[model samples]
Target chain A: MNKYIQDTHAHVLIWLEEAANMIRESFTEQLIIETKSNFSDLVTNMDKSVQNFFIQKIMEYYPTHQILGEESAEQFKDTNREHVWVIDPIDGTANFVKQQDHFCILISYYENDIGKLGYIYDVMNKNLYYAIENAGVFLNNSKLPTPPAISLQEGLVSIDVRNWYGKASLERLATEAFDIRYFGCGGIDSIHVITGKFAAFAASIAGPWDIAAQRIFAKELGLCVSKFDGSDVNYLKGGNWVISNKAAYEDLLTIVKEF
Target chain B: MNKYIQDTHAHVLIWLEEAANMIRESFTEQLIIETKSNFSDLVTNMDKSVQNFFIQKIMEYYPTHQILGEESAEQFKDTNREHVWVIDPIDGTANFVKQQDHFCILISYYENDIGKLGYIYDVMNKNLYYAIENAGVFLNNSKLPTPPAISLQEGLVSIDVRNWYGKASLERLATEAFDIRYFGCGGIDSIHVITGKFAAFAASIAGPWDIAAQRIFAKELGLCVSKFDGSDVNYLKGGNWVISNKAAYEDLLTIVKEF
Candidate 1:
C-alpha cells in the first residue's frame, strides 16, 4: 500500500471505531425519526448526526476530500476531487428505527474513481469488516479466506423478498436454490456472503450508499457484483445488483432474471 | 405459580443454560451433518448430541416425563401420557450449519395437551426467553410487557418469502402490509414478533418443534397462533400457520388468505 492510502486507511479505522461507539451509545437515547421516500424508508436523528460526525472528521483530516452520504448527499456538489468518500451512516434505517440491531455503517473510500479502502461495520455484533485494495480483506485483523464457490442448487441466498412476491423466481428458488432468507439489512446480509455463510444476496433496489462499500469488498473477495441480467454494477447509481459466489452468479441470474 | 411448577421452571432454566453452552462449544468441533426431508433441511451431529444431553437430564430428574424431540422423534412412540415434552434440539439446523448464528433451541412442556412451560433459547445471543402457564413471559430475568395491538400497515411482518415469490399473497402483502422479510429460522424469526419488533410471522410450513414452544409463548403474550386462513395450528401436523399480534392478525389474514 502507498503511504498516502495506508495512512488514510489507518486514520479511517480509528474514526470508524469512534463512529461505532457513537451508534452504540445512542441506543439509550430517544431516536427522533422521519419518513423518507416512503413510510417504509425511514431516517432518524442519528442518521444525520452520524453523517455529520464523519464529515467533520474528514474535513479536519483532509479538508479537500469530498463526501457523498445518505443523509447529506445534497450538500455533496458533484466534484472532481481525488479523494471521494461514499458513506451510508446507517444502511438499514428502518431496521435501525425498529429493531435497533442488524443495521450497519457502510463506508468506502475511492481515489479518482478507483477503490482504495472499504469498511462494513456491524455495530451491534462488533464486527468490523474492512478491505484495503490489493492487500486482502480482514474481519477484525483476522484475514478472511476466499469463500468456497457454491452453486445455487446447494447454496442459500439472501433475496429481496418484496420484489419476488409477484414474480416467478420465488417459485423456482423454492425448489432450486437450497433455500432463501432475508435479514433486511444489506450490510449485515452482505457480511453473510463475505464469510461464506450465504452464497448470494439479490438486492432488487438499493441506494448508492447501500452498495458502494459492498462493491469494493466483493472485488477483493473474489465475489461477483453485477446487475441481474449479467451486466456490470453501476455502484454510483444503484438498482438491482446480485452479489454472489462466482459459481452461483449465472445460475441465480437465470432464476431471477425477471426480477 | 405452584411450588412444583416453580421448582421445575427454575430447574429447567439451569438446564437450558447448560444446553446453550454445549451449542456454543460445538462451533469449533467438526459437525457431522445429514440432510432431512430435503437438501436444505439439515440435521447435524450436534443436534443429536444436544437432544441426548437434554434427554439425559430430563429422564434422570423426571423419569416418567415423556419426551418428543426432532433428533429422536422416531423413538418417541405416540403416547397418551399426562406429561409430554416437545423439543427441537437445534431449530434452524441449516442456519446452524451455515451461519452458525441465528439457529436456536425450542422446548415446550405440556400436561394433557395444556402448555405448562415453554423455553426458546437463542444460543449464540444467549437470550433465554421463557413462559409459564398462568404467569407471563420473561427474557432472561426481566419480564416483558404486553406489546401494542399493531395494525398490518403499521407493522412489520416476517412472511415466508418462498410462498410469496410464486403466489398471489406476495402481491397482496406488497400493497397491504407495511413490509415483509424472512430469516428462514422460525424460532429466530418469531423472536421479532415476541418482542413486538414484527407484528406477525406467516409460515406456510412448520414442524412441531418449530412452532410448539412459540404457541405457548403466544398464548401468554396475547398473540394469535393459527393457520394463515385463520384456522387452528396443529403443532404436530406442520402446515401453514400465522402467529400474529391481535390487531394485525385479521388484517394480515385478509391479505394472504389465498396463500
Candidate 2:
C-alpha cells in the first residue's frame, strides 16, 4: 500500500469507531424516520447523521477526496474524481430501524476508478471486515483465509426474494441448493459468503455503495463477484450482482438468471 | 409450577449446560454426519450424542417420565404418558455442520398433553430462553416482556421457502409485509417471533419437537400459534404451522393459507 492510502486507512478506522459510537448512542433516542422509494426503504436521522460525520471528516482531512454517500450523494457531482470514497453510512436502514442488529456500514476507496481500500463494519457485532487492494483481507485485524470451494447442494444460499421475479428465482434455488437464508442486509449476507458460512449471496438489485466493499473482498479472497449474467460488475453503477464461491457460481447463476 | 416440574426444571437446566459443553468440545474433532429424509436433512453425531445424553439423564433422574427426542423417538413407544419431555438436542443440524453457530437446543415439558415448561437454549450465544406454565418467559435469567403488536406491513416475517407452495406464500408475504427473513432454523426463527424482532414465522412442515417448545412460549407471551388455516396446532402431529403476533396473524394467514 502507498503511504497516502495507508495514512487514509488509519483515519477511516478511527472514523468508523466514532461513527459506531454515534449509532450506539442513538439507540436510546426516538428515531426520526422517513420513507425513500417505499415504506420498507427507510432512512432514519442516524443515517444522515452518520453520513454527515464522514463527509465532514473527509472534507477536513483530505480535501481532494470526493465523497459519495447514501444520504448526501447529490452534493458531489463529479463522478470521475482521482480520489473517491463511496459509502453507505447505514447499508440496511430497514434493519437498522427495525432490528438494529444485522445492519452495517459499507465504504470503498477508489483512486482514479481503481479500488484501493474497502471496509464493511458490522457495528453491533463489532466485526470490521476490510480488504487492502492486492495485499490481503482482514476480519477484526486477522487475515481472512480463502473459503473452501462448495457446491450448491452442500452450502446455504441467500437471496432477495421480494418481487415475483425474485420469488420465481427463490423457488428454483431453494430446491437446488441445500437451503435458503436471508439476513435482510446485503453487507451481512456478503460477510457470510466471504467467511465460507454461505456458498453465495444473490440479489436482484443493489446500489454502488451496497456492493463496493464486497468487490474488494472478492478480489482478495478468491471469490467471484459479478452481475447476475456473469458480467463484470461496474464499480460506479451497481446493478444485480452475486458474490459467490467459484464452485457454486455457475449453478447459482443458472437458477438466478431464470427470472 | 408443581414440585415435580419445578424439581425437574432444575435438573434439566444442569443437564443442558453439560450437554452444551459436550457440543462445544466436539468442535475440535471431525464430525460424523449422515443424511436423513433428503440431502439437506442432515444429522450429525453430535445430534445423536446430545440427545442420548438427555435421554439418559431423564431416564435416570425421572425414571417414570417419557421422552421423545429427534434422534431416539422410536426407543420410547408410549405417547400417552402423563409426563413427557420433547427434545431436539441440536435443532439446526445443518447449521451445526456448516457454520457451527445459530443452532440451538429445544426442550419442552408436557403433562398429559398440557404444555408446562419450555426451553430454547442458544448454546453458542448462551441465551437460555424458557417459559413456565402460568408464569412469564425469561431470557438469560431476566424476565422477558411481551413484545409489542405489529402489523404485517410494519414488521419483518420469516418463512420456509422450499417447495412451490412456500415460494408462492413467500411472494405474498414478501410484498404484503415489511420484508422477508429466514435463519434456516425453526427454533431460531420462532425466537424472533416471540421477541418481536419478527412479526411472524410460517412453515409448511415441522416435526413435533420443532413446535413443542414454541407452543409453550406462545401461550405465555400472548403470541398466536396455529396451523396455516387458523386451526389449532396439533402438539403431536406437527404439520404446517404459523407462530405470529396477533396484529398480523389474520393478514399473514390469508397469504400463507393460499398454498
Candidate 3:
C-alpha cells in the first residue's frame, strides 16, 4: 500500500477508538433522537456529532478531499474529485437507539472514484473490520482468509423483510434458504457474511454510505457484491444490494432479482 | 419456594454449569448431525448426550420423576405424575450446528402439572435466565424486574418466518410492529422478551420442550403466553405460541390468529 493510504489507515484506527468511547459515554446520558424518512428510521444526537468528528478530521488532515456523509447538510456533487470520503456515522441508528448493540460506524475512502480503504467499526463489540485496496481485509488487525464457499441451502441468510416490490423475492429466498435472520443492521449482517456465518445479506433499499464499506470488504475477501439484479453496485449510488458468498450468489440473486 | 424446589434449583444450577462446560468442550471436536422431521430439524450427538446426562441425574436423585426430553426414545405420557421434568438439551439445534452462538438449553420442572421452576441457559453468552414459581425471574442470580408494557408499534418482535399457514399473519405483524428480528432460537428470543429487549416472540410451530421453560419465565415476568388464537398455551402440547408483553398481546394475536 502507498504511504499516504497507510498513514490514513492509522489515523482512522485512532479516530474510531476515540469515537467508540464517545458513543459509550453517551449511553450513560439520555439520547436526543428524531425520525428520518419514516418512523423506523432514526437519528440520534450522537450520529450528527460522530459525523462532524470524521468530517473535521478529514478536512484538517486532507484538506482537498471531498466528503459525503449520511448527516452532512451540503450534497457532495463533485464526482471528478481525486479523493473522496464517504461516512455513515451510525449504520444502524435504530438498533443503536433501541438495543445499543448490533450497530457500527462505516467509513470508506475512494480515489478517482475507485475504492481504497473501508472500515466498519462495531463499536459495542469492539471489532474493527477494514479492507485495503489491492492488499487484504483484516478484523482487529488479523488478516482474514477468503471464507469457504457455502450454498444458500447449506448456510443461513440475513435479510430485510420490509414492504417492498421485491417481497416475493425475499419470501422465496426465505423458503429456499436453510433459514433467515436479521439483526436489523446491514453492517452486522454483512459482517456475518464476511465471517462465513451467513451465506448472504440482502436489503431492498440502502444509501451509498450504507453499502460502501461492505463493497471494499467483499472485493478483498472474494465475496460478491451487486444489485439485486446482479448488476455492478455503484458505490456512489446504492439502491438495493446483496453481499454474498460466491457459491450462493447466483441462486440468491435468482430469487432476489424477481422484483 | 418450597424446600424441595429450592434444593432442586440448587442442583440444577450446578448441573447447568457443568453442561455448559461440556458444550464448550464439544466445540473443539467435529459434530455428528442428523435430521429429524425435515432437513432443517437437526439433532447433533451432543444433544442426545446432554439429554441422557439430565435423565440420569433425575433418575438418580428423584428416582420417581417423569421425564420428557427432545432426544428421548420413548414418549413420556404419564401427565398425572406429581413431579415431571421437560428438557430440550439444545433449543436451537440448527443454530447450535451452524452459528453455535444463539442456541441454548431449556429445562422446566412441573409439580402437579403446574410450572415450579424453569431454566434457559445461553451456553455461549453465559447468561442463565431462570424463573421460580410464585417468586421472581432472575438472570445469572440477579433478580430481574418486570418489563414495562410496550405496544406492538412501540417495540420490536421476533418471528419464525418459515412456510406455514399463518404466513399472512406473520407478514401483518412484521408490517404493523416497529420491526422484526429473529435469532432462529426460541429460548434466546424468549430471553429477549424477559429482559424487555423485545415486546414479543412468536413461533408458528414448536414442541413441548421448546415452550415449557418460557412459560415459567413469562408468568414470573408478568408477560403473556398464549396460543396464536389468544388461548392458554398447553405446556405439554406446544403447537403455536407467543410470549409477549401484555400491551402487545392483543394486537399481536389479532394478526397472528388470522390463520
Q: Ten-residue segment with the worst summed lDDT in candidate 1 chain A?
A: A72-81
lDDT per residue (tens digit) for residues B26-70 in model 3: 999999999998878899999998998899889989988899898
Worst window of 10 by summed lDDT in candidate 3 chain B? B161-170
Once model 1 is optimally superposed onto the true structure by TM-score, how far is the C-alpha of residue B163 displaced, in angstroms? Answer: 3.0
Off by over 4 Å in 3: A164-166, B164-166
Of the candidates numbered 2 and 3, which has the greater TM-score value?
2
Tell me the whole-model lDDT of each prediction, alpha carbons only. 0.85, 0.88, 0.88
DockQ winner, 2 or 3:
2
Residues A83-182 of candidate 1 have per-residue lDDT tens digits of 8889999988778877778899999998887888899999988999998899889999999988998888878899777767656777887778888888
Candidate with maximal DockQ: 1
State, as a TM-score between 0 and 1, how close model 3 is to the true structure: 0.96
Q: Write the per-residue lDDT of candidate 2 for residues A106-145, one digit (tens) a residue.
A: 9999888788999999999899999999988998899989
What proportion of the real contacts between chains A and B does each prediction keep?
A: 0.67, 0.64, 0.43
Q: Where does the lowest 10-residue lDDT sum fall in candidate 2 chain A?
A: A161-170
Model 1, B119-191: lDDT tens digits are 9899998888988987999999799987878888878789767656667777888767777778888998998
